[model samples]
Target: MAALTKDSMFERHIEDVEKDIVSVTSGETRPAAGIDSEVANFFASQSQGPIEIDEATDRRLRWMIHKRVLLVMVVTYFAQTLDKGTINFASIMGIVEDTHLVGQQYSWLTTCVYLAILAWEFPTNRLIQRLPIGKYLSFNIAAWGAVLACTAACKNFTGLIIVRTLLGIFECVCQPAFVFLSTMWYRREEQALVIGAFYSMNGFQQCVGGLIAYGVAQIEGQVLKNWQILFTMLGCITFVWGIFVGFWLPDSPIRATCFSPEDRLLMAERVRKNETGIQNKEFKWYQVREALSDPVVWSVTLISFTNGMPTGGLGAFSNLIIKAFGFTTLQTYLLAIAQGAIIMTFLFSAAYLSKRYNQKLLLAIIYTLPNIIGTVVFLTVPTRSDTKVGLLISFYLTMAFGAVSVLNLAVMSNNVAGRTKQVVASSLVFIAWAVGNAVGPQVFRANDAPRYIKAFIAHMVVYALQVVVLFFLRLYLMRLNVLKRRAAALRESTANGEDRDEHLAHNHAFDDLTDRENPDFRYTY
Candidate 1:
C-alpha cells in the first residue's frame, strides 16, 4: 500500500486482532450496543485480580441475618394471626353465648376488620416509604399488641367491634412493612424462600394459638373468661417482641451493622445486579404510571381476590367446622393442632416448588385445585357417620393454599419495578384480599351450621373461579415476556445499524433515548 496512512494501518491491525480474539474466545459474543465491552474495560482497569473473601465467614454472617430477620417476621405475623384468630377461639369458649349477637351480626365483626384494612392499606404503605421502616413497623406492632390485649376487656358485641376495628388499623402496617423490609435485604431469587419461612407461620400460628388456648381454657379462677386470658397472653408476647425488634432489626444493607463493610458492599452490589440498578434515590411519577397501566397487575389482583374468599371463610370458621364434628372443646383444640401441622407441611412443599421452578401461577392453581375438590366433597358427601371422616379431612385439607398466598405476595413484589409502584400494587392486592375477607364470612351464617351448605357451595364457586383467573394470568404474563424480548431485539438491531436518519426516527418513535439515559432499567417479568 503506497505510503500507508496511520488510520489504514491501525484499521488493518484492529481487524487482525479481532480475528485472533474471536478464535481464542470460543463461542463468546459481544452485545450489539457495545455495552459488554465497555463494562469489561471498566472492571479490567479497576483491579489486577478477582476479589477475595472467606466463604465460611460470609456464610456465618448471612446465617445470623437470616435468623434474626426470620424470627422478627414470624413473631410479628404470629401476633397478627393470634389477634385475628382469637375470635374463632373465643366463639368456641362461649363469647357468642355471652354477647347475644345473632345471625349476620357475628359476621360483621370479621367484615369490619377487613373493611378497616382496606381503608388504611394504601396510606399506611406510603407511610412506610416515607419513614424509617423498622421503627415504623415496630411501633405498629406494639400498638396492635396493645389493642389485642384490650380485646380481653371487651364485654359486648359493640366492645368487641371497637377493639377489632382498632386492631385492624394497627395490624394493617405489619404485612406490607414486613414485605418491604425483606425486599431491602434479599435479591428476587432468594426472596421466595425467606418469604415462605415467614409466611409458614400463618399455618404455625393455628397450632401455637390452639395450644395456648388449651392451656388458658384450663384456668378456672380468672375473673374474665379463659378466651380473654388467651388474648392477653398473645398480646403480651407480641408487645415484648416489638420491643426486641427495635434493637435487633436493621434498616437496610447500607445501614446495617451486623455485617462487615465488605459484606455490606457485597449485599448492595448483589441486589443492584439482580434489580439491574441501585435503589432509586427518588420516586418517579412515570414509573408509577407504567406499573398501574400494566395488565398483569389487574390479573394478579383478580386471582388474589378470588382465592382469598375461600381462604378467609376457612380461616375464620375452621374451628366451628371442626366443632361440627361433635368433638369436645379439648378434642377440638387437639384436632386444630393436627390441622395446623398438615397445613404447614403443605405450605413448605409448595414454597419449595415455587422457589425451585419459579412457577408461582402454576403452583397457585395447583393449590386451589385441592380446595375446590375439598369444597365439593364437603358439600355433596352425605352427612352419615361413615362420611364424617372425609368431611373433616377435607376441611383441614383446604388450608393448603396458605403457601399460595405467600407466593402471590412474592410475585407482586417481583413483578412491580419501581419502589412506589411496588407499594401501590401491594396495597391494591391486599385491599382485594380485605374485600374478599369481608365477603367470605357473610357466607357462613349461624343458621347454616352442621352442614354450612351455602358456605361450602360458595367456596367451591370462588375457588373454581380462582383457578380460571390464574390460568389466564399465566398466559397474559407469558405473552408480555414475549413482547418484551421482541422489543429488546428490535432495539439492539437498530443500535447496531448504520442508517443514522432511520435510527434517529426509530429512536424517537420508541423513546430509545430513555433506555440510554437509564441503562440499568429492567422490566419486571
Candidate 2:
C-alpha cells in the first residue's frame, strides 16, 4: 500500500487520498470482480464503505450459498476422491496380479499419479486464476473421467501408468479450486467448516467407494476383469457428473445466476471482511515473489509435506496393509468402512474445534497426538493373528492426520492474500504434497511388505516433525499479528473523528494487496 505522511495517517480522510493511491495499487487492478464489476453490472450499486448486514440476513445468505455452492463443491470433491482411489480399490481386486506388477511396480503405479500432479501444479494454478473456474474444472473432470475409463483397457503396467498420469493431471484442479472457492464465497470465520465439509469427502468416499468396489468385484465375466469393470463404472459416472457440474455450478459470486443482483451484492458484502481480494486477472510478479519469500508460505509448505507423506501412503496402500494382516480381500474392503468412519469422526471434531476456537494451528498439532500413538503401536506391535484388531485400530488412529490436512487448508486460505500470492502459496503447498505422496509410496517397498517396519519408523519421525512445524507456524503468525497490532497502535494514537472511520473502513479489502500490504488484514492461525 502507499506510504502515508504522519499528517495524512490520522488527520486526512481516505476518500481524499483515493486520488493519491496509485502507489498502493501500482501493479494491481484495484477492486477486482465482486466489489467493482458486479456493482457496475447490477445497476443497483453500493458505494464502498462498511456494509452493515444484520445477523439473521447474514445467516440466511450463508445457508443459501451452502445449499447451492457448498453442495457442488462436496459432490465434485467426492467424485475426484473416488476416481483417484480406483487404483487403491483395484489393488485388492487383482490389478497387480493381472498386470504382473512385481517388486516396486505397484508402488510406482501409485507414485506416478502424484508425480503428474506435481508437474502440473504451477501451470494448473495459473490456469485456475486466469480461466473461468467452474467451466475449466468441469472440462478437466470430464477429460479425466474418460482417461480413467481407459484404465480399464490397460493390459500392462506401462499402459496403466499412462492413464493414471493423465488422471492426476486432470484431477489436480479440484483442490486449489475448492480452496479458492471457500475464500470467495465465505467470510474468514466461516471458512473452516466449509473446507472441512467438502474435504471430509476424502473419508466419505471410502465408505461409498468401498461398497461399490466390493459389488463390482462380485461380477462374473471373463470378457472383463473385476478391476476393469470397477474402473469403467467409476470413470463413466464421473464423466456424466462432470458435464452436469458445468451447467449447475457458478464461476464466481459476480457470476452466480442463482442469486439476484441485490443478493449478489449482499454476497459480495458478506465476504469483504476477509481482506483477501476475490478475483484479479492481472498476475503481479511481485506478489509471486512475496509468496516465495514469505515465511508463512514456506512454513505451511513444510507442514503440508510432513502431513502428505503418511496420507499418500495410506491412500494407495491402506487396503493392502489390511490384507497383510491375513484378512481375505473382501474382508479388507469391509473393514475399511470402519476406517472411513474413524476419519469422518476426526474430521468433524477438527472442524468443530476450528469453528469454536481461534487456535487453528494448535488444533492441527493436538489432532496429530492420536496419529503419533497410532504410529508407535504400528511400529512396535507383533503382527500375529491375535494382534490384528489392535493393529487395525492403530491404522484408524493414524487417520487423524486428515484433520490436520483439512485444518491446514483453512489456515493457509485464511492467512494468504493477493491473487497471485494465494495461487503461488497454494501451488507450493500442493507441490510439496505431491512430492511427499510420491516419496510416501516408495517407502512401502515390496521387500518390506506384510509389515513395513521401516516405513512406520519413518512415519513416526515425520509425524513428530509435523507437530513441531505446526507449533512454529503458530508462533510465527502470532508474532506477525503482534507487529500488525503495534503498527495499528501507533496509527490509532493520532486518529480522531473521520480519521477513525477512514482507518476502520474495509476500502482496501478488494485492493488486491498482499496480506503484508493490507494493514487491516489479521492472521487467524
Candidate 3:
C-alpha cells in the first residue's frame, strides 16, 4: 500500500486524534466520540495484536534484530574504516614521493576527501530517504571500493585527488545511513550501544590495519608500490562485501527478509513508544524548518564539527607523528596499534557507561576531558627522549575525545523524532563533521613539521568548547522533556472532561509529526 500523503484525510485527522490515541494508550477513559472508528481502527487493521506486544516476544525479537544488525554494521563499518585508514598507512609507505606531492598537496589529498563528503552530504541523505537504503548503501560501497582500487593507478596529486574525491562522495552516505538504520531498527536506548558497536570498528580497523599494513608492506612487487597494493587489496574485499549487503541486508524492519510475518509485526510494534515514527519517504518541508530552528540540532552540529577536527588530524597524520619520534616505518605502524587500542577502550567503555547509566550527555561531556588534557600535555610537555613516552600517551588520550563524538552521534539519533527532521538533522551534523575534517588537515602545515604545536592548541580550544556545548544541549533537552510532560498532563486532564471530537479521533500513527508538535513525544536525554 502507498504511504499516506500530506493531503490524505488520514493525515488531516492526525492532529485532532493524536491526543485521543495517547490518552487511550495510557489507559485513560476512551474519548466520547469513540476512537474505535479511526485511530484504533488503523492499529487493529494493521496488526494481529496490540501495538505493545507481550514482553517475552518483544525481548526475543529485539535480540534477533540486534544480532542481524550488529553483524552487518560491524563488518561494513570495519571495511569502511579500514579503507579510510589506508591513507595514514600509505603516507608511511612512500605515497608522497610516488604521487609526486608537493607542499600541502598531501594535506589536500586528505582534505579533499572530506570536502567531497561535505559537498555531497545533503543530496546523498535525500537519496537515502527516497531509495531503498540497503541497496543504495550497497551500491555506494561497491562504487567506493572500485574508486579506492583505482587510486592504485593514480601517480600524481591530481589523479589522487580525483579518486579520493570520488571515494569521499561514495562514502558520504555511510555515517548518516548507519545512524539512520540504527534508529530504524533499534529503540532509543538500544541505539547508543548499536552505534557504539558498529562505530567502534574505527578502533578495530586501526588495530587490524597495523597488522595488515605491516604484512602488506613486506610485499615487494616490482609492478606496484606497497601503498597501491594496500589500496587494491582492501578495495577488492569491500567490493565483494557490498554484494553481500545487497543480497542480505534489509532496508528497514518492515522490509526485513529474515523475519517471519509475525516477527516483523512485532518489530514495528516494538518501537512505537519511541514516539519517532518509523520510515516515511515523502519529505515534509515543515519538518526541515523545525530541525533548522531547533537549538539542540545546532548544538549537535557544532559538536560534530569541533570533535571532527582531531579525527581529521589524527586520521591523516598519527603515523607520521610516531615516525617523527624516531621510530622506523615498521615500528611506527606497530606503535599506532596502541592508538587503536586506546580508541576502542574509550569508545566501548563510554558506550557501555552511557547504556548502563542512561546518560549520553554526561558521557559525552566526560569523554571530552581526556582530549582536553591530552592536547594540553601534548603541547606543554617538552620533546625529550624520556618525555616521548608521555607524548605518545597524550596522543593515545586524544582518541578518548573521539568517544565523545560517538556519544554525540547517539545523542542526535536518540533525540530527533520525526523522520524528515532526523534525516535533515543527520545530514547537517555530518556536514559539519566533514567541514571540521577538511579544516583539520590544513592546520597541520608543512612548516609545523614534527611538533605541530599550533595543531595541538587548536584541538585544545575545540574540545574545551565541546564540553560547554554538551552541557547546554543536555539542559535544553531536560527543559524540553519537562515541558512535554507538563503539556501531556494538561492534555490528559482536558481529555477526561471533553467529548471526543470525531476529527481528533482519526489520528494516524505515521503522520510524521515533529517531536515539538507531537505532544506525546518526549526527548531522551
TM-score of each: 0.82, 0.90, 0.88
The candidate maximizing TM-score is 2
Please provide, for model 1 over 1-525, each residue's C-alpha lDDT reduced to its tens digit, 9 standing for 90 to 100. Answer: 555786597457445433433332342322221222322343344443333335685566567667767678877787788778888888888788777777777788888898999999988988886666778788888888888899888878899899889888988887887777666666676677777877777778789878888888888987888777788888887788787788888766656777666665555444442332223333456545545665566767776687678777778788878877777779889888888888788778877887788678788888877787777778778776677778888887788678778777777766555465666677888889888888888888788886789988887777778778777667655544333333334332332221223221111111111121222222232
Clash pairs of candidate 1? Answer: none
What TM-score does structure 1 among the candidates reach? 0.82
Higher lDDT: candidate 1 or 3?
3
**Model 3: per-residue Cα lDDT over 147-221, one tens digit each:** 999989998988999999998999998899898888777888888888888888888888899999999888874
All-Cα superposition RMSD per candidate = 12.4, 6.7, 8.4
Count of backbone clashes for each model?
A: 0, 0, 2
Tens digits of lDDT, candidate 2, 181-211? 8999999888888888888898898898889
- Clash pairs detected, candidate 2: none
Q: Which ten residues in a row have the lowest lDDT in candidate 1?
A: 504-513
Instruction: List candidate 1 stretches off by more than 4 Å.
Output: 1-58, 276-283, 490-525
Question: Which whole-number lDDT from 0 to 100 does residue 343 have in model 1?
Answer: 78
Runs in model 2 with CA error above 4 Å?
1-48, 490-503
TM-score ranking of the models: 2, 3, 1
Q: Is candidate 2 or candidate 3 better by lDDT?
A: 2
